[model samples]
Target chain A: MKARVIVSFKDEVLDPQGLTIKNALHSLGYKFIKDVRQGKVFDIEIDGISVEDARKYLQEIADKVLANPVIEKFHWEIIEK
Target chain B: MKARVIVSFKDEVLDPQGLTIKNALHSLGYKFIKDVRQGKVFDIEIDGISVEDARKYLQEIADKVLANPVIEKFHWEIIEK
Candidate 1:
């Protein structure tokens, strides 16, 4: 099975990279863009774990190594392939 | 409206960071893991654009500034909220 984890900065955190991108977009004539925030995704392939165990395991992976608990948040979905 | 863009490496590319994380997982006992790949995402908020125009604008943003087309692929979805 495959799993995808998305990690994003917490809502209140300052995002300098995102702000830069937003400003650049504005100069590029995308004046309608109001804000931009950036995040990460990790795609993993797991071998032969039960569906129940897979969900638990993926969440553990996400929480432990995929995201920083203090300033970042993460969630994951198992992919059927 | 909002748009989320996901950027991922092309399959043939070497992913050193992904490898390092996977090896760490191995040392921590996730031996069932076969592969890991890393990517990025951008979340943008747009003000009062029509749905059709928003989609087109987001695609251009994704193509032009959100991703490196040489080694990465990007896809985006507009959010309703």
Candidate 2:
């Protein structure tokens, strides 16, 4: 199975990296951009696992390793099975 | 409009970060994981622009700023309008 996971800071958390990107865009004259949020994406392939087991394992991976519970959250979906 | 952009290393490029993550997962006992690739995601909101213009500007941003053409590629989609 192939999966994609996205991990991002919570809305309440300040994102300096996103602000930096927005500033860069403004400097480059992309002034129409109002906001930018930056995050991490993981493309994962799992072998020899049922779809149900893959989902559960991916969920556990996202929670335990991919995201920081204090300020980050994660979402994952199976892209292929 | 709101858009999502993903930038990732080209297949020919080596991704040490992804390898590190995969190793970490392996040590943590996610033995089913076959491969992993890491990438960046940007969530952007554009104001006062037509969807057509927004898409064009976003394409430029992805090409010129978010992705390194030498070793990375990018894909983007408008999420809201």
Candidate 3:
């Protein structure tokens, strides 16, 4: 099975990297852009596990390692099974 | 419109960060994991433009700023319009 976990900052958090990218794009003349938010994506492959078990483990990994609960949140989905 | 751009290392590239994470996960006892690939996601919002224009600009941004063609590849989709 393969799953994708996306971890991104909370809505209220300040994203300096995203802001920098937005500014850079504006400087490059792509003025239509209004906002940008950046995040991390982890594509994980698992072996010898059922879909149910994979889902459980993926959630645990996202909660324990992939996301910072204080400022970030994560969502994951199984892409292949 | 809002678009999501995902940029990931090419398959042939060695991802040290992913390897480190995999080792860490193994140490933490998640033995089911077989492989992990990490990437970046950008949620971009554009205003006052047609979908066609947005797509064109998004492609340009991904090529010029979001991804390194030498070792990385990117895919983008309109998530909201």
Candidate 4:
């Protein structure tokens, strides 16, 4: 199975990188752009794992490694091969 | 209409954030984790625009604002309401 993990900063966390991109977009004449929030995506291929196991494992990964719980949040979906 | 934009660093660019997460995962006992690359996803709601027009406008936004062409790549999909 494959999985796609998305990790992003929480709403109250300051996102300087996202802000920089937003400003760059405004300068590039995309006035329609309203907001920009930057996040991370992890595409992974996990072999021989059941969907339930995958979810549990991924959650652990997210909590312990992929995201900082205080400032970030992560969610993932198992992809069908 | 809604759009989902996925922006990522090109393979050649160094992703320190991704590396840090990968290392953290290793430390956290996720030995199964092999590689981790991070990217951004933009969920946008675009009002009053045709799909083609939206694509064109988003392309300009991505090129000029959302992504750094020198180091990043961006792709977006229009979502039907």
What TM-scores do the predictions have?
A: 0.96, 0.98, 0.98, 0.74
DockQ of 4: 0.43
Residue-pair clashes per candidate: 0, 0, 0, 1
DockQ of each: 0.89, 0.93, 0.92, 0.43
Q: Specify the CAPRI tier of model 4.
A: acceptable
Query: Which pairs clash in the backbone of model 2?
Result: none
Residue A1 of model 3: what lDDT?
85
Candidate 4 residue A79 Cα shift, in angstroms, is 2.3
Best by DockQ: 2
List per-candidate RMSD values in Å.
Answer: 1.1, 0.7, 0.7, 3.0
Question: What CAPRI grade goes to candidate 3?
Answer: high
Across B1-81, the per-residue lDDT of candidate 2 in tens digits comes to: 899999999988999999999999999999899889999999999999999988888889999999998999999999989
lDDT of candidate 1 over B1-56, digit per residue (tens): 88889999999889999999999999999998899999998888999789899988
CAPRI verdict (incorrect, acceptable, medium, high) for model 2: high
- DockQ versus reference, model 1: 0.89
lDDT of 3 by residue, A1-81 (tens): 889999999999999999999999999888989999999999998999899988888889999998998999899999998
List the candidate 3 regions with Cα displacement exceeding 4 Å. Answer: none
- Tell me how large the interface RMSD of candidate 1 is: 0.9
